[model samples]
Target: MRQATLDAMDEVKRSLDGIEAARARLASRPSSLGGRGLDGVFTRYLDHGSKQLTWLRGTLGSATALAGVASEVGDSGMELGILQMTGPRLQAAMFGTLLLATWVDFLQLADALLRDCPTCGSEKLFADLHRVQSRMTPTLADLASGDSERIEAAATAMPVLMGELTHEFDTIRREARSAMEVGGKVMVAAQVMELLALISTLNMSLPRPPPAASTTLGMGLVMSSGGVIAGSRLVVSAEWVEMMRRLVQAGVISLPAVSAAVRIHGGQVMMAQANQDLPEGVREALGDSPEVRGMKVTGKAGAGMAEAPRHHVMPKEHREWFERRGFKGDMDIDQFCVRLEQSHHEAIHGGANWKLGRTWPREWNQMIMQLLGKSGRETGRALTRNEILNIVAENMKLYDIPMKFTKGRRR
Candidate 1:
């Protein structure tokens, strides 16, 4: 009877494993590859972890074969018992992979929201690419030439570039914390954060040495798209804006980093989004909005807020699909984003320049004051960091980019 009990427990464990794997896949839906663009790319990466779990399940199947062989040897399935422990380890591996992929994907998706029109707050996605290119081109020279004078000149100018880089990393870190890791493991957050700091540390390396693998903590975040930040309140946060404005005088605080951080801060702007359940049929009339499903009628359909004709995006697959239909070579996503920023003129609210290219230094905390001063004179409202995030989310809604909730939210 005891032996039978153990066997039953093993079967239950196997069944439970299967359920967990399935749940993860359903929640993550991790691939938008069929037509969703980057959103799909990220989802597919998450799905890959699910596929790994399937392999683990298959590995466990071999346990039965070992059990039969042990039975033949009169060993009471001793080999199978040995194989049992492997399942739990594989389970851990699957969980780790899922967590990693989810965080990375969350960062990417959030950035998409920021870079896109509407969410960029009157800016384009690649607004800062030129700045990066300028720094990278010469810095690449520093990395190659090793001349002290040229390197020193590069170093003096680095804070501007470093600011952007720092802001980008901080944004990735901050958004990764809120959206991706919410209700998830704190240790996981710590690890990812350490990885980010490691990247930041990499920025100051040229004067002494190129960033070593150890310093990066193995993240290899590099010049890849992973370095981009999502739009966020941090960009326009009163604290940061005031700080950045003072940077011109201070001479060094990382304007680029500040810009990147602002973008990251903007990514926090997520709302329940309008849906069919919301007042007015605007959601439905928008033709399957990406931001909402449908709308609900609040009053007689002539309410005060309703008069503005509140429209929301449902599922933008069809619209975006048509937009990208004739694309051939790799899309010039950077220039496309620049145009997006220019789309908004005097109507630019909240006093942010809204040009991705126009950014402040990160370490220069005084820019916040300048920004607020400018806001007081222009927009009549000085925003806190959180307000900036809300506006960013609003902008994302306008752009029609796909924003997904974390995997746990699927249920």
Candidate 2:
């Protein structure tokens, strides 16, 4: 088996050489060969096809062998499944490892493609930021429209928004693997489960930009909080999501700012789609988050709390009752809502306004279009509206009472 593995590995090497040669030969050839007037580069994807084929074969063989072992172990009645197998336990472990290993191999290749210029094989980042950006150089001006800018901004911000989650996952990988004993393993296991949820929530949180604006209008709330990586955009990066999962699970960041807790049920956005205008600093503090875009407007679902009463007191009835005497039955929930579900959501949010509010006023919803700007003025991060919202919402709780339904219903 070892020799076979080695032989397969060797074959891959030979194939890689052939691919390089094909590319080199194509370089000397003219544009007829699809070099597109370029040297040492293939004008088309076919140029590197042979090497890819080789890599795939070797990868498949190793992955298959490991996966089989994993399945057998999974069939066993073990306490826990892991890779250090002498028996069934080993099998399950191998399966999990193989999956991650396969993903890693792909990651390396994809990273190379993005980081190294495909045409010149140069390390000088020709495509890493956003693949969309590299393709849009039309050399012709006045041919573009506002739509193009909006599209570019969104596509560019996708990965940048996934920033914190990236670091969280890195920490998880390091710490989770190091926990070997029962207590340590248990801790890591629980954390892994929670982190997994955080990761999923983050993904769902920023899957796409709102339909209204070409730019990220809804994500204003997320960016203003500084969760945004400086040069990136709305697209969530895998690395960033993973990091956030790890951090929250491990208790690194208590009360992690996960995706807003709106559930989609029966074709309806369950929570109020909503907010009211705060001062400029408050707005800035909200960040360019897609979630809180147009904090001065109303909600999509017509259920925002900001449109409720503005008085510092609770619901009129509740307050009157309190002023006169106490209630007869249990009115904690109802009473609290009176304090929270008010005009501008301020009746509830007055003390907690610093947090990225989950709810908004009616009018602010329309102003969402002006949320996050369309550009990343830095060199390393991109600004996605959702990310900005998460940042702002998370930070806001500091000044308030941390009123999340979980985060004080900032759900």
| All models, RMSD in angstroms | 31.8, 27.1
Candidate 1: tens digits of C-alpha lDDT, residues 101-140 = 3333333433333322121221222333233334344443
lDDT value, candidate 1, whole model: 0.31
Q: Per-model C-alpha lDDT, please?
A: 0.31, 0.29
Q: Where's the lowest-lDDT run of ten residues in candidate 1? A: 330-339
Task: Give, for candidate 2, the lowest lDDT window spanning 10 residues.
Answer: 260-269
- Where model 2 places Cα greater than 4 Å from the true spot, the runs are 1-40, 43-53, 73-411
TM-score of each: 0.21, 0.18
Top-lDDT structure, candidate number:
1
Clashes of each: 64, 84
Give the number of the best model, judged by TM-score: 1
